[model samples]
Target: MKAKLGISPIAWWNDDLPELSDDVSLEECLRQSRSAGFTGIEKGRRFPDDPTVMSSILKMVNVALCGGWFSGTLVNEDIATNKHRIQPMIDLFKAVNAPCIVYGEVGHSIQSDRSRPLATKPVLSDADMKAYARRMTEFGEWCAGQGMPLSYHHHMAAVVQFEHELDTFMKCSGEGIPLLFDAGHLAFAGGDVLRVIDNHHKRINHVHVKDIRGPVIKALDWRTQSFLDAVALGAFTVPGDGSLDFGAIVQKLAGYGYEGWFVVEAEQDPRKNPPLRMAEMGYAELMRVTTKAGYVVEAPTFPWR
Candidate 1:
């Protein structure tokens, strides 16, 4: 099996909670990621929207563009509106040759709202989920036609947070909407990570190798604590440092012939866990696990090199 290691800029600079971010520029983030042995980095707010500018910035560290999140409001919005809103990112990702665009449905999501409790997250009925899934399939198809595929992200504090909700959404949706397998979010929502991969391995186009602190997650009172509260309590960390067994996770993915980017995407306070140190630790753990999985881990190939 073949694979590539990547890291998300959210570890360095969080867009949702700016206070958790490190005081660093876009170039610095890329440099640190590369220094930690990651040859690819995901998009962030500091990244230039212009494709040319973004490419130039990434070239400085010989890092390739992997994937980035798009807050999709397709739960309530129409296809045309979302299509228009996503055109720039589609164009940018296509230009950079990214694997896929991470689609996280943010409509009525309380992930960023500190005042709202986790128990108060939005929920939809079976019929409602079917309708929403149809729309998502349509959107995903359109994105693929535009040369940028959509990988749906089932996040905590969102509509499709739980395992049953994800299963229902997947059953309703078609192959057009591929899944972005996130181990941390699924574990945080009380789902079996291995079970999710076993069920949806067919539709998984992208992967987020996120790890979480089980104790911190279990200590949170869903009725009174928010997702951000859990984050503030150091609920998440990179692999090998936290509770997830990435060795088994990577081995399972390799068994399915999965060859794509395995991105480290732990979002926590940069002050508590220094970004450079965390990046190195994540890269080390991934190297250990991916090597054990028999993956020939590849590095970035710069066109101008």
Candidate 2:
């Protein structure tokens, strides 16, 4: 099977290192991604938010905008508030021709209405679940009408972190909305990545090919801080170096007939690992895993000029 691979530009943005800025420029990032063998890239917040600018960049590099995460409160808020947060993002994404907006747990707590850890008391009651489902359905329908899909993200520190929470969210959301599966995040949250895909392969629309160091992941608990916090602390990394079984994941995705982009998403501290080297290493690892799993990995075209 022929598969298109990509990388998240966020992999190049590490807050801990100031000297690495030169390496993360748009031109350089695209150059490294292509040289390292990625066919596309997911736009990060550091990229220009304006649709025209973003479109121009993607066109220049011959890389597709795979999609990005929208960190807004969708599950535990009123419909109006949720719409307010998501509508503009959807419009912006539409303008760029991106396929989906990765949906994850909101920052605030749904139960206490106060700022609390995402793994705090789950606020999803039966009524809340139904309402969430209705809201997600509405959002999915809206996105479909606009020619985009809402790919829900199962984050480690979010409300849908654990297996049960993921199960509840998927059950409540029904069949309309698709999911953006992040292998590392699921593993960090104590989920069986292969099993989740096996059960809900149909709902998976995109894949974030990230991996995590088991020791680093086990050192932190969701009850203490958010997943984004862990990301800032360099909790995740590229495949092969971490504990995830990418060979199994690739085989399972292939079995499920998934043909979407496999985006390399390592949100780590670049101070520890330079972004360019990381991208090169990550691409090599991804290629090895894909090839071992009986898939043809395409060589990416370098566009440094």
Candidate 3:
């Protein structure tokens, strides 16, 4: 299997929590990513909206645009509103040839709300999920038709946060919407990482190989603390430095014939764990694990499109 190694810029500069970010420019972030041996870097708040400008910035650092998050609200919004909102991101991704847009469900989500407790996250009933899933499928179909397929990101504190919730979402939704498998968030949600991959391997188009800091996660009071609170307490980290066994995880994915980008998306405080150092660690661990899984890692290509 062939795969590309990538990292998200959240480690360098977090959009949700500016206090946890490193005071760095976009060029410097890309430069550090390339220096850490990451051929691709996902979008962040510092990235310009114009594709040409974004391409030039990436080219200077010898990296490519892998994928980026797109906050989606299919739960509360209609298909028409979603299409209108996502068209610009679709155009941008198509221009740069990104693998896929990470579609994070943010409607009624308390992921960014520091005051709200984790246990207070919104939930969908069986009937609510059935209808929401259909809306998401249609939206996914439209995004695919636009030449920028979306990978649904089941995030923490979102409506579809838990393992059972993901199962129901997958069962109700069609293949029109693909899955963005994130190991850390799944682990934080009390999910069996390997079991989740086994259940939804067929629909997984993108992967986020984030690792969890088990002790910090265990310390969090779910009823009093928020998702962001767990993050503030250092609940996430790069592979090989945390709880998950990426070697076995990669092997499971390889056995299932999955081939695509495996991005390191551990959003941590830059002050405690330097972004470049964390990026290097993530790259090395992924190289070791992916190679063991018999994957031929590809080099970054120029002219993103």
Task: State each candidate's clash count.
Answer: 0, 0, 0
Question: What is the C-alpha local distance difference test score of candidate 2?
Answer: 0.73
Ten-residue stretch with the least lDDT total in model 3: 296-305
Clashing residue pairs in candidate 2, if any? none
Off by over 4 Å in 1: 301-305
23-129 in candidate 3: lDDT tens per residue? 99888898899899889988988898898898788778778889999888889988888788889888988888788899999999999999999999999999999
Candidate 2, residues 282-303, lDDT tens digits: the string is 8888888787777786633332
Instruction: Assess the local accuracy of residue 65 in candidate 3 as a C-alpha lDDT between 0 and 100.
Output: 86
lDDT of each: 0.92, 0.73, 0.92
TM-score of 2: 0.85
For model 1, give the RMSD to the true fold: 0.9
- Decoy 3 TM-score against native: 0.98
